[model samples]
Target: MTDPDPQPWLRLDPRMLLVHPAREVVRFLPVLVGILVAGGASGAGPWGLLGVGIPVALGLVRYLTTSYRITGGRVELRRGLVQRHLLSAAIDRVRTVDLTATLAHRVLGLATVVIGTGSVAADADEQLELDGLPREQAAALRVQLLQSGAAAADDAALPSGTPPVPVVRFAPRWLWYAPFTSGGLVAAGALIGVLSQTTELFAVRIDVTEDDLSALTGLAVLGGAVALVALVVLLAVAGYWVVNAGFSLTHDGGAWHVRRGLLTTRETSLDETRVAGVTRGEPAALRLAHGARLSAIVTGLARSGESGAVLVPPAPRDTVADAASVVLGTPAPMTAPLRAHGPEATRRRYVRALAGSAPVVLVLVGAVVAGASPALLVVAALAIGAALALAWDRARSLGHTLVEQFVVARSGSLRRRRDALATGHVIGWTFRDTWFQRRVGLVTVDATTAGGQGRITVPDVRVGDAIELADAATPGLVAPFLRLGSDA
Candidate 1:
């Protein structure tokens, strides 16, 4: 079917004029104050005002100069004082439109509309965000954009029939045990800070006579042992709670919107076609709890801010699969049971964990030298135990699947996890083996997705199998000669 014709543009509500010139002014006040205070203290005199005043004035001017108009067919933004700027994009190019209101804006009945378009203008793909718009006006503008021809392309691509919106999902409230469990660590850190400061100021010293040492050692043994166990229990619970907050995946209109976060709520939406990958994560303890988290990598959305990916914490495994199907445009394949790798692979992961604990080991060693007795050996043993537990967890969490156009990896203990990436989204691929891995015929496969840092590395796969998996996931990455070799 042919696409609908574009409509003519219309002016936005005059209330759009409320976008305060002072809002930007207020934003920079803290920095301006810091500069002013430092300069005046340093005897920069009125010269300090010159540094502060110019930038604030320039910012105010820029803010005042900015204006936006949402037409039936296009959105236009005009800004700049001395130099004029007019940015316009067809309503058809608009990819996604978002509405946001801070507490102040909510009180003022104003909202901001951030419109994302494929075309870039003035160094950004966000067409024109109309801030300080009346709530109705913002809603009307959103409706206009959604009804426009551009939205038709999005609607046509979505799966037919609306999916149910989750009214109640895993929220932070379900995990209050997290704070108490983790609160002591924060308290302990604060106590350490206080003690360190006291020591620096007063040069306090503990002199242990033989009898005093015996008593103090007994007390230390009791306190340290209790604190260590409490800290571990708290940390595990806190991690679980954090992994469970703000879990929601909703199908709104023609796109999937995932809202998650604990302290700061994050909402991300993407067209079905743009989803490049989906990942699930679970901790060992979470596995027993029958909870898993889901994450997705999608295209078209901004990589920065809260728009990059969808994070669902502590979702049931079935829920994760449902969300993945909605977001990734295909049913999530069943994950294979995790199997232990070769002995060398297991040893490598364990040794790596041990290497990471060097600093903690050194601290314990230092405590022994400081006449704290060799009791720190308990701490070292606990640390080693935690490391081994994590290694065992990883071994239990290892599994992968090759789907039609995606490669899926599932890992995590207590909390189980999975990641699915489309072959086409594989921007870069690499196979790496250290000298030791080479001798053992083991390798790692890494793939780069569109958003975020750090490559996704599946470490310790068999060398030949790793190459074959990489080729299956990203046929373009394999050489033509390799294609013949594979067929042969």
Candidate 2:
């Protein structure tokens, strides 16, 4: 027997040519320059016309060449010219399908749909990218691929299907977390870079010089720095509002829909079955400010990027808890009272923190005594005190518990984190024992998974107790390798 022919591929939209040129003009700057030179050298003759016509003519060729298909069993993409590229992946291997759009694409009613396989490589070759699809069509494709799972492949060619129920939506008040998100510094720097690039690209000149800096006094410089920092904070707050203004999360038809962004307007969906766990991020600043965020631990999302499909962004703790419970069908465990590790753990943490701060203390004190900046002494002392206090707080935060179908782990002090993970979704168990940890009879048990941060670590627990907790969380998942009475 032989495999049957695949379904016909859907041709790419002609608008793709426009979208490509809009985003990729920088890539083809050399081509544009060549055409300009040809035009200037040859005037309005055949060469000038050819020079003006090359981009549009070639863009149409490439646009017509590109196409994609969603067969019953596989997703395929074919594009390229002198060196053609083709991609095909079994529908079952599809781990995630994200719909992304920049401001331009949103205006054009287009989106880029990315299909990911649960691989760790940065290149993500196993993924297929379908660029410039109508937004509605992309959403339908996501539903079809996810509903099929990897176990089977069948085209459920249908309409956009039913929408999900709204679980959470951002309020204008949530913008309070924006400045604290990065203290506004990052957003400010990004805006400055963009402005610089734009002006230099267009050959514009600013009305400032080194003479301006030379004219400023010490107090003036300090004032400038303060002003710049404030500006940055404002930019960050505005950026947050722009991106998360209408953010919402909802559930329907066995998947989670994440819709957010103002100018770019993105719609990302995740298969409910693929949710490995949920994470609660409660930074000290944000927590004190009465804010928290919730994230779903799903397969093939960004492993190291900030805000990688966060389920809830900067909301009250209660709101985040409610949203998590509703969307994940778990208890949320946001209010799980942590059980602290013993005094020995706290002692170890204190000693480590003090030891780490010793060098800085010595250097700064010595510098002040040796007639360097006396202000350094105060800064160093404050830093050491903060570190010591943070270590104590971190020790208090080290706690974990297995609550029915969830394993709750809490750790950190500067920025506290609480993980509520589904026991069954845990792929493996790793017991980490350092020389210090072994001497103290403490171990860190990390529950490995295919999504989120890749693992949820239960730190600073008694060795025997750790094993029991892991075992109870997922029976037989951690028992086989343990020998309680002897070191196995």
Candidate 3:
């Protein structure tokens, strides 16, 4: 009862590939008539059915040819018709077991599961895919993989788990934030572009006088712009609803459980003890709205570079704080006041930024005014001002501090990130100085580690402060590498 069931050899459901062919049926009349007119197929009525049957036939072949098994502490996959190919990954090294099911897969009650080593160090040519698993089976497999991986590879599994407690729950009011985040804007832009392109493909002929046609063209353009904006907003709002609706986070057993999505439900679980660090991203817009998003940086999980593994979807600062307390294990330092790198860094940023931007602005305003649009000058001035503000913000954000077992680094200008890395995970120190930084007696120190952002960079650090800070963050890790001229 204690051990998991041995993974049985599995094949994809033949119904999985029917997703696209189902579309052919939806447009059966048009597709069939077109095929008949073009003589694309040998026969008329039954022959057109072949268009829809091809994918299903291929799926049957794949279902018969491809096979996978998860047993004996490793996952094995094999698939190929002409040439046999086999790939295996140790269950202990598995960082992520991601399950995705589109509407089509859901209709057939199947999901595609990707088991990754959790490191992006490998190229895309390497894929760990086991497509079309039953939903319940996939979930069971994910749990088995995580539990095993956590206990052995990173000693991530906790002896016990806290009782199920809601860390973050959906708030209908936060729906307003949907338009600002990734899905909303992206969906809106895509909808606009698609509609515009579709309109372009249609042929329309009109006869009118030159002046009348001009007026009509202006009206059409204005109406089209308005329509596009409206469509974009609608799509964005709808997409936001579908992706983030019913979002919730809970602590169950030794892990954190996250669930979200509208049509295609997704649930992810991460063992708390195995988490390497925590990353908080504050986009300028989110910062303005007093909101932030948080992600877990864990030892074994493929991460979108820089963001780590996002745990908390964009939410209010208070919500983030609550989630952080549970994930990072303490009073959340996300909102804590951070130390600055000094006025010297600020001065350097301002001087360098404006120095680069001022010439372009001046040239556009003076010499280029007649040849180029005045709007260019205006844009340059605005960009220069924004860059100056961001530079100052970046300087203010520069700092590294040690709070007990945590080594925190604050950096970034526009999309500001605050990384709270566990001190025990700190592996080594990297110290580098640019020519300008050296002249100013400042250097950049990066804390290189095994997982989570790989390294945390603290720029404009005085050499003396950098060494002392490193010594504090991880006591003996950096001491041997440093030179104490007088002590030696």
Top candidate when judged by TM-score against the true structure? 2
lDDT of 2 by residue, 100-203 (tens): 88887887888889776665656544347787888878877887777777323323323335544478987888887777676467777778899999999999
Count backbone overlaps in model 2. Answer: 1
Please give the ranking of all candidate structures by TM-score, highest first, separated by commas.
Answer: 2, 3, 1
C-alpha lDDT (0 to 100) for residue 470 of candidate 2: 80
lDDT of 1 by residue, 1-488 (tens): 22365433444344433334345447767876877888879987786767556665665565577777655466788776887878787765555566666655665677767776633243653346665567777756665664463346555443335556663377544453343333446656766788899998899977768997667767798998888767655665556554445556666555555555443333444444555676666555445555555655655444453234544554465666666665666784434443345677777767777877878988998888888878898898888888788777766566666776777766554445566788787787776778888778777777777643324567787766677777787775665556554331
Best by lDDT: 2
Clash pairs for candidate 3: 95-300, 118-301, 118-302, 295-311
Q: What TM-score does each of the candidates earn?
A: 0.65, 0.86, 0.82
Q: What would the TM-score be for candidate 1 when compared with the true structure? A: 0.65
lDDT of 3 by residue, 255-282 (tens): 5667777777666666665677788887
Report how far residue 370 has shifted in candidate 1, in Å.
Answer: 10
Cα misplacement distance, residue 461 of candidate 1 (Å):
1.1
Q: How accurate is candidate 1 locally (lDDT)?
A: 0.61
